[model samples]
Target: MDQHSDAYFISRVVLFNDQKAFEQLVKRYQKDVRSLLLRLTAGDHHKTDDLAQETFIRAYTYLRSFKAKARFSTWLLRIAYNIFLDSVKKEKRRKNTKLYPHQKSINPESGMDAQLDYTELMKILRPPERAAIHLAYISGMSHGDISKIMACPVGTVKSHISRGKNRIRTYLKLEL
Candidate 1:
């Protein structure tokens, strides 16, 4: 589709609350959103799904407010990013409250596999750094795209990626 047609298509779904049009939008963007969420949540499939769902729900709810100053993907990703941060905050509060007594503790030395270690490393990074690295490395977003999604400058995005990568490398004991 041409750029204007695509914008009009998405705008119809937003302005008119067209379910089929929204579904088309979902089919077009769901994979990218889920993949971005998966990386941000450190490959936690369940949390990724939950966050992606929340992201889309939020986007649809706020669709009428969309200014169209940015691409739909960029706008959707900004929503997803907020959802991720909210989820993380909620999880932290839940942990602090000990709401679930039956949760299993993760042991670093249990030979769990590299995936677990990577997950643990992600947990250690600050949210912005983690988001930046995940967008750049895992989702393959350009620095400029990440900047738009993050509402930060491109140079800040690059700095986050560099610092996040360095921290992860140190955590994993990898030479850079």
Candidate 2:
């Protein structure tokens, strides 16, 4: 039921083995999860989809362990973030490549007038900075919520957003 609370759905899952309740949770947050992943993956839809699938799988496996200290969505995002970090670590071991495995080079012929879009702008940020900026600005989450998700202090989240924004501003100015 659309009107059902997350707690109700979660309770059903924990007590009655309700798969549908879990599906409801997944459906409610999949777009949000996928969008965040798409940003992190630099718009690699295939990789984003795979990671998103892994995220839900892990979430379902670990649903019983959820303590409800934070919002369910926040918990799910934390799982996604951890999975992304794990994948990044694995990729580094596999190829010893840069962050974006299939990073595209700027076409010299595209000329000086090319302006960086959001994805291009995000590419300039380090992972922690990118995650902080996205959670704060795009997800409309509080600094405290982001700190919980990132498993860091609120001050650190604020610092990440501040530094990330400064980097983006500098990059945009240079691009122009």
Candidate 3:
């Protein structure tokens, strides 16, 4: 592989504690990581930015654990996915405990990005379904790879995609 390839950059970071190498990796994949997080947060730009930052932090912290068997992007996205899950759990706990009475739910109009039907559609799917569908279709990952990133069985990933598609079809029909 070329010197500028992901494998090279990853090796530099892992072997030499090269912050510059990691920075290069971050610059290379920041857009993909942010895009995934933005969708997961339902167009909530603030939350997405926070989650994306956390993803990179965790990735650098655990850089040695990466086996290089999977693509670097996949590993980074897995970190992003786990961070998203943790945030969702934290938010659920906050709501369940009534920690903030004034805190409002995600406001569709408050998102900084364009409010497209795609964004609205993403809001409808459950987190796993949204992640599965996004990784499978948008990220163009195989179900096998998605299973690895999601830490779920391949069957479960398939089921999520199936259900997500059905939900979208049903939703579109109703909206029309």
Badly placed stretches (over 4 Å) of model 2 are 98-112, 174-176
Give the candidates in order of lDDT, highest first. 2, 3, 1
Better of 1 and 2 by lDDT: 2
Candidate 1 lDDT score at position 35: 81
Model 3: per-residue lDDT, tens digit, 68-133? 888888889889999988877687787775422222334444332544466676776777887898
- Which residues of candidate 1, in runs, are more than 4 Å off? 1-5, 97-121
**TM-score to native of every candidate shown:** 0.77, 0.87, 0.82
Distance from true location, Cα of 152 in model 1, Å: 2.6
Worst lDDT run of 10 residues, candidate 2, spans: 103-112
Using TM-score as the measure, name the better of candidate 2 and candidate 3: 2
How far in Å is the alpha carbon of 75 misplaced in model 2? Answer: 0.9
Give the Cα error of residue 146 in candidate 1, in Å. Answer: 1.0
Give a tens-digit lDDT track for model 1, residues 31-66: 988987876776689988988998888888888888
Residue-by-residue lDDT tens digits, candidate 2, 1-176: 95799999989988998999989988999998998888778777999999999999999888899999889999999999889888988998899887655334444443236665767656667777878888888899999999988899999999988877777656554441
The number of the candidate with the highest lDDT is 2
Question: For each candidate, what is the lDDT?
Answer: 0.75, 0.82, 0.80
